[model samples]
Structure formats: structure tokens, C-alpha cells
Target: MVSEEEGKILIRLARKSIESYVKNKSLIDIPEDTPETLKENMGVFTTLNKNGMLRGCIGYPEPIKPLINALVEVAVSAAVNDPRFPPVSESELDDLEIEVSVLTKPELIEVEKPEQYMDKIKIGEDGLIIERGPYRGLLLPQVAVELGWNVEEFLYNTCVKAGLTADCWLFKDVKIYKFSSQIFNE
Candidate 1:
């Protein structure tokens, strides 16, 4: 778990990012001492809804930058770039709730069948990363319960998204890993 001080800083930085972007449509610079530990294979998600149905959800599967920057970028992306929804109007800002989930680093495994995967994965604890050839994809731990998918099924779907066969993860040089998160929402 992150310390209370760290949590305050993170929340402050995130709210600042939101306010700035929503007001002047500008990006916020990442703060220094933003915790290097939080910047590894982490992700930031913004979950928006209207009348209890999902409106937009967007984020990074890997930490491409500092956590604050990643959060701001992905929040804006979810608000405006989610292909599934129209751009979020300013009026909807109050109704939108941002939920952040930082992921753990995925661990690659060698297995011969789907059954081999079941024993190694924890449905609600381990986030997954899968890579094949030049393609890669990820699923946060929460996705399992949300979709009611078993570990093997989740892996297969992730692989398919990367344009690989369901069993591609079993192939040579294919990579996989798992990570946990410190999740928060508002």
C-alpha cells in the first residue's frame, strides 16, 4: 500500500490535472518525486457512465510516462477520445467519476495448455500482460470479475486483441506477466 502522504499527493496532482485541462484545455507537467515505484507497468483509467451504463473508459496498459502525466493524458483521452462515446461535455464533468488502477508487472510463463494457466493465475489479484510478435495487450485484475472470465479465457481474448491466436502465449518468445494495483475511484 502507498503511504497516506503519497496518496494525498497523488490525489492532489490528479485533481489539478483535471481542473487545468477542463478549464483551459492544457496538459499538466508531472511533479518530481512522483514515486518511481508507481511508474512501472502502471495504468490510469477513467470510467465514465450515464444512467448506469458505460460511456467511456480509457487508459494506458503500461506506464509510458510518470503516473501523474499518464493519469492526466488518459483521463482526457477517455473524456474525448473514446471511440465508443461522443466527447464529454463540460456539463457532464460533475457526473463523471475517475477510477485509477495501477497495474503490476506481468510475468511470462511457459505452459502447454489452458489448464496450466488456471493454477497460476488469481482472478481478482493479478493483472495480465501478453505479447506476441510485435503485438501486445493487457487486462487489469478487475476485468476478470467484471467480465466473468476465467484466466485462460482472459488470456485468449487479450491475445486475440493483439492479432494472435488464443494459444499464442504458449509460443516461443511470447511474453506474459502479472501485476496488482492500488485502485481508487470518485
Candidate 2:
């Protein structure tokens, strides 16, 4: 678990990375004093919110690189590369509140019936990942709380995000994975 101080460091690093990229098109060098725990290759996402609305969100959902490295990469991507929203502008930096979600590895939820999924899911506590063939989608844990959606709605939306039908989870070939996150924001 990350302490409050560590979380704040992550937020600061993310903001610096975004600002550096926005103003000069360069990634910030990870600070020299970064804590070792913050350097673990954990699954991490950087979210940018402006005036309380989502501006952009992106990250490495898998532990593919050091958390410090992933922070710099995804923070910049969220600022300029999220296709759902336009690139964040330089003026928006001051108003942008940054969030970091460190995710646990997603575990496939095995159940005999689609109805069983509701039993396994824990709304605000669990994130969802839906996959079928080559398509996949992920919805972070806070998404449900922010949108006030129940399990069914969350599952359906994740399927759509994966470019599949809302009921795709009912199919035998589809896969459902659930994960928890350590979330912090500023």
C-alpha cells in the first residue's frame, strides 16, 4: 500500500510530466529521490480532471514497467492522447486535478451463468475488464461511483467499450475479469 506522502509524490510527478510535455514536448526526468516502493512495476493509470469533469484518463493497466516510468508515460498520454477527449491545453493545467489508480492484477471471474456476475462484483470496490476474441475494455473502480451505475450497467458499458454488444458477457466465449485499485487524487 502507498502512504499518503507517496501518493502525493505520484501526483506531483504526474503533473510535472504533463506540464513538461505540454510546454516543451519532453518527458520529465523521474525525480532522484523517488521512493523504492513507488518504483515497483505496478499497474497504474493517470487521470486528468478539469473543473470536476473528466478531461482525459490513460495508463498502463498491466505492470509492464516501473511505476515511476509508467507515470510519466501515461500522464502525458492522458493529457494529449485520449481519443475520447481533445488534448489538454496549457491553460487547463492549473485547474486540472490529477488522480492515480494503482490496480491489482485482473483475475478472471469464473461463473456458470451471466447472472452470477452480479454476485461477484462489488460496485465501487472492483474494476471490470471484459474481453472477447481480440476486443477488450476496462472500467476503473471509481467509474461506478462517479456515474452511479449498478453491476449490470457497469458490465454492459465495459462490453461496449470493448466494441462488443452490451450482452456480450452472456456469451460463453467472452471473459470477465475483476480487479481492485488503490486510488488517490489531488
Candidate 3:
């Protein structure tokens, strides 16, 4: 788990990365002596909100890089590369609020039936991932909390997000995974 001070440092790093990108400046460099925790591989998401509305949110669901590096990449991507929204402008930076979520490694949950999976989920705590063959969708833990979704609603939405039918979880082939996160916001 990241300490409060470490979380603050991460938030700062994310902001600096986004700011640097918007201004066309060099990316902020992580010092060689960075904390070991920051250097560890981790999955991270950066969420950008403007005036209480979502601006852009993007993340890596799997741990592919060091935490600090992932933060920088995802921060800039959330600010500029999110396909759902146009690129954020420099003027809009001041109005934007950044939130970072550091994820625990996802654990696959074995179940014989979809309804059985529902019983395993803990609302507002475990983030859900539904996968089958080539399709996959993930909802971060905070998503359920922020949207006030119960387990059923969360499952439905996750399947929908994966481009599957609302009841896709009922299928026997669907794979379910759950993970928790440490969320920090600016």
C-alpha cells in the first residue's frame, strides 16, 4: 500500500505529466533515487474531471510498467488521447481535477455459473472484469461507488461496456476477475 505522502507525490507526478504534455514541454523525469514503491510494476488509471463532470479517464488494467511511468503515460493519455473526448486544451487545465487509482493485481474468480459470480462480488470494493475470448471490459472499484451501482447493475454495465449483451454474465464461457484499488485525488 502507498503511504499518504507517497500518494501525494504520485498525484503531483500525474499533474506534472499532464501539464507538460499540454504545454509541449519535456516530460517530467523520474529521479533515479525514486522510492522503490514507485519503481515497482503496477496498473494505474488517471481520471480527469472538469467542473464535476468527467473529461477523460484512461488506464492500464494490467501491470505493464513501473507505477511512476504508468502514471505519466496514463495521465497524458487521459488528457489528450481519450477517444471519447477531444484533446484537452492548455486553458482547460486549470479547471481540470485529476484522480489516480493504483490497482491491486487482478485475481480470477472461478465460478460454475454467472449467478454464482454475483454472489462473490462485493459492491463498492471489488472492481469487476468480464472476459470471453477476444472481448473484455473492466470497471474500476470506484466506478461502482461513484455510480451507486449494486452488484447486478455493476455486472450489467460491465458486460455492456464490453460490447456484450446485458445478460452476458449468464453465459458459461465468461471469465470473471476482481481487484481492489487505492484511489487518490487532487
Candidate 4:
């Protein structure tokens, strides 16, 4: 688990990273006293919100890089690279709130039928990932809680996010995975 102080450091780092990117400045250096947990590889998502609405959200679902590095990369990418929104301008930095979610490795759910997957999910606690062939999409755990969606709606939305039909989870080749996250916000 990340200590409160470490979580604060991460949130600050995310904000600084986005600021530097928007201003075309050099990347902020990670502090020498950073904790080992931050140095370890971890999956992370950086979420940008303006006035309580989502501005951009992007993440790595696997622990492919150091936590600090992943945080910086995703923070900048969510600010500028998310296709759902235009690049965030320097002027918008002050109004933007940064949220960082450090994810646990996703575990695939084994089920004979797609409908069985619903029994394994906890609405406010487990993030969902749906995959089939080349298509993949994920919904963070907090999404369902925040949107007031039931289990079926969460699954349907995740499928839609994957560019599949809303009922794609019922298909034979579909795979479902679940994971939790430690979410920190500014």
C-alpha cells in the first residue's frame, strides 16, 4: 500500500508533468528521495478533470514501467494524447484536477458462459477489462460507482468502449478480467 505522503508526491508529480508538457518545458526530475514503491514497475492511469467533468483519461493496464515513469508518461498523455479531447492548453492547468490510479494486475475470469462473469464483479471495487481478438477496452472500478451503473450496464459499456456491440460479452471468444486500484487525487 502507498503511504499518504507517497500518494501526495505522486499527485504532485502528475500535475507537474502535465504542466511541463503543456508549456513545452523540460520534464520534471524525480526526486532523489523517492520511495521504492514509486520506483517499482506499476500500471497507472492519469485522469484529468475540469469542473468535475472528465477532460481526459488514459492509462497502462500492465505494470510495464517504473511507477514514477508510468505516472509521468500517462499524465502527459492524458493531457495531450487522449483522442476523446483536444490537447489541454497551459491556461487550463489551473482549473484541471489530477487523479492517479495505480492498478493491480488484472486477473482473467474463468467462466463457461459470459453471463457468469457478472457474478464475480463487485460494482464499486473491481475494474473491468473485456477483450476479444484485437479488440480490448477497460473501465476503471470507480467508473461504475461514479456513474451509478449496475453490473450489466458496466459490462455493456466496457464492451461498447472496446468498439464491440453492447452484448459482445455474451460471445464465445470474449475474455473478462478484473482488477482493483489505489486511486489518489488532487
Cα RMSD, each candidate: 3.4, 1.0, 1.1, 1.0
Q: lDDT of each structure?
A: 0.70, 0.92, 0.90, 0.92
Q: lDDT tens digits, residues 13-33, model 1?
A: 655666577777888877766
> Measured by C-alpha RMSD in angstroms, how accurate is candidate 1?
3.4
- Residues 1-186, candidate 4, lDDT per residue (tens digit)? 677888999999999899998998567777788899899988899999999999999999998999999998899999999999999998999999999999999999899877787798999899999998999999999999999999999999999999999999999889999999999999
lDDT of 4 at 101: 95
Which order, best to worst by lDDT?
A: 4, 2, 3, 1
Error of 3 at 121 (Å): 0.7
Show where candidate 2 strays beyond 4 Å.
none
User: What TM-score does model 1 achieve against the real structure?
Assistant: 0.75
- Predicted candidate 2 versus true structure: per-residue lDDT over 19-100, tens digit per residue: 9999899988988999999888888999998888889999878888888898899999999999999898888889999999
lDDT of 3 by residue, 46-162 (tens): 999999999999998888999989999999999999999999999999999999999988999888766787689999789988997899999999888889999999999999989
Q: Would you list the rank order by TM-score, best first? A: 4, 2, 3, 1
Error of 1 at 57 (Å): 3.3
Q: Between prediction 1 and prediction 3, which has the larger lDDT? A: 3
Ten contiguous residues with the weakest lDDT in model 1 = 37-46
Q: Give the TM-score (vs. native) of candidate 4.
A: 0.97
